[model samples]
Target: MAATIIDVARRAGLSTATVSRALRGLPNVSESARARVQQAAEELSYTVSPIASQLSSGRTGAVGVVLPFVNRWFFGQVVSGIDSVLRANDMDLLLYNLGDTRVHERFFERMPVRRRVDALIVLTLPLSEDETRALSSLAVPVAVLGEPTPPFWNVRIDNSVAAATAVRHLVNLGHRRIGLITGAAHDPRRFATPILRRDAYRTALEAAGIRYDPRLEAMGHFGIEEGAAAMAQLLTLPEPPTAVFAESDEMAFGALRTLRRMRLRCPEDVSVIGFDDHETAHLMDLTTIAQPVVEQGALLARLVLKALAGSHEEPSDTVLPTRLVVRGTTGVARRDAAPGVPPSPGAATDNGTGARGARSPVP
Candidate 1:
């Protein structure tokens, strides 16, 4: 029913191969031939088949986007960005969501993407040695959106610096007793974010001459319920922290909900800060570190496309900027100090240097 390459070639008075090359804008096709092929195609209302194009070019014209969880906010935003670019470039996206250890292991073992996609964009998915080897052996160009992994094009923010900046914000607010709620370190898909944040929290305290109190730390598993539970446990401690920091906006929301249930006035009783300037963070009035989550996805997708087009070479990582965003949730330490000890002295100032700071689930 539709015109094929043969029809276009005959109509344009050129060979089929010439017509194909001309339509695709491949080298060696003269401008006159390309124009003739275009005119013929338009006259016949003909469109090239994507499958046939791939077969001829030896390219899938598709990208494999691998993420640990797609339903999470960060991943969803990232996916949206990637999808936008892929769509504009006339390419398809084959998403791979490794929601559990079994699924993750199976995907890596099979490495099916090698045969189905032209390039890969891995979003904060940590790889074991074997997995890394498998990915490298796939011979597909890979782009990562997280911490830098050698031999792969990457886009990321410095987690350590971002976390330190967050903690420093609280410190500048005259809060000496700071507590942290972090994700579980032992999770199968665990990456360096939580660990790096936790370490930076301690480092921030040390820099301010505050003692590192292990009792002030709680593991929230990066969930709302877990954050609430962790906050509840912290509240039960002998001397609760004056301020708390959740590693993600979701966790911070959970912590804030728990504080409300306990009739604790934010900033007046316990100042709370979180990472990721999630859309809801403003609604919650949460003070947080904002990272360009969606932009990272867009950048990685661009790199993937470039590599697939045989344009990107000399592997390099793109480190994005981050910034602290102060809001109503965080403030100066409560004035109700102990009988003798004075509250740490500092004005409550938003320390966001307009520089920057998730891999939290979306829902």
Candidate 2:
């Protein structure tokens, strides 16, 4: 039969309560008592019940991760990173995917994770005032991934700077007319990332002395199909842009597909750039703004652990750095190509500019 705490207490010649306290490394237990309990536990092969330990410690031994989409590549990577840290620390992860509007509302209304987790990690979801209050009422340590919410730990990259770097790369390549494929324009959730990137795109264009043309911008909603449709729409415009910046690699893949279907060569006809440097970005040969997706997730987990340990430090807002990774997808604009007209079929590709190994400085 498996040995229990009672067996350990008998072997150590101590009361059951003292054995429990010593085995848990709790205070009020002398060093000698702790040593005796440890030896007794080893000799008797006794183990403490995880449930009982949690009950005595007043902690759930699990962390809750809340995000919009679980299936998306970005979120998947982040979760993996978080799980790595938590698993190493002997803790559990409870995921809450609030992808659907009803589910999101229900989660906030029910407050299911209130006492079930030791801490919470929110990923890139824009919370309303009521929702924020609801999360605060949970009384758990909270960390946010994308935006800085006061009184909560935050870990994120500079979206505005990253987006501007992508646009500036194309402008430096002598592309006067640039297009933007973004997910923020019509999103009801009002996610902070897309909005910041969109505003940066406009600001970058103005800085480059290019006119802000609404017709050059299309809403992809950060999906492959939506990106394909948005690309087609941009191609149909009277004066199509020679370069396009997609807010995500998935969307950029769709744009590349659209270019193939229309028999237009990348860079030679339409230079395309994307963000996130996703796993498949290199396979697609996409130029993008690369952020440390896994690192950000791991940092957030560390911050939560610190908060859980009763760290008195002020809530930290950590903004990680992003870099421009130039690949084959972006190139110099065709000098001979006129506005409102596509370049000639025989036009040579401008591979010298924005080629692989070329990197734009992130400001």
Alpha carbon lDDT of each predicted model? 0.84, 0.88
Residue-level lDDT of model 1, residues 82-173, one tens digit each, is: 99999999889999999988999999888879878899989888888888788899898899888888888989998889999999998898
Best-performing candidate as measured by lDDT:
2
Deviation in angstroms for 285 in model 2? 1.8
Worst 10 residues of 1 by lDDT: 354-363
lDDT of 1 at 54: 90
Q: Candidate 1 versus the native: TM-score?
A: 0.85
How accurate locally is residue 48 in candidate 2, as Cα lDDT from 0 to 100? 85
TM-score of 2: 0.90
Off by over 4 Å in 2: 10-14, 29-40, 344-363
TM-score of each: 0.85, 0.90
Candidate 1 clash total? 10
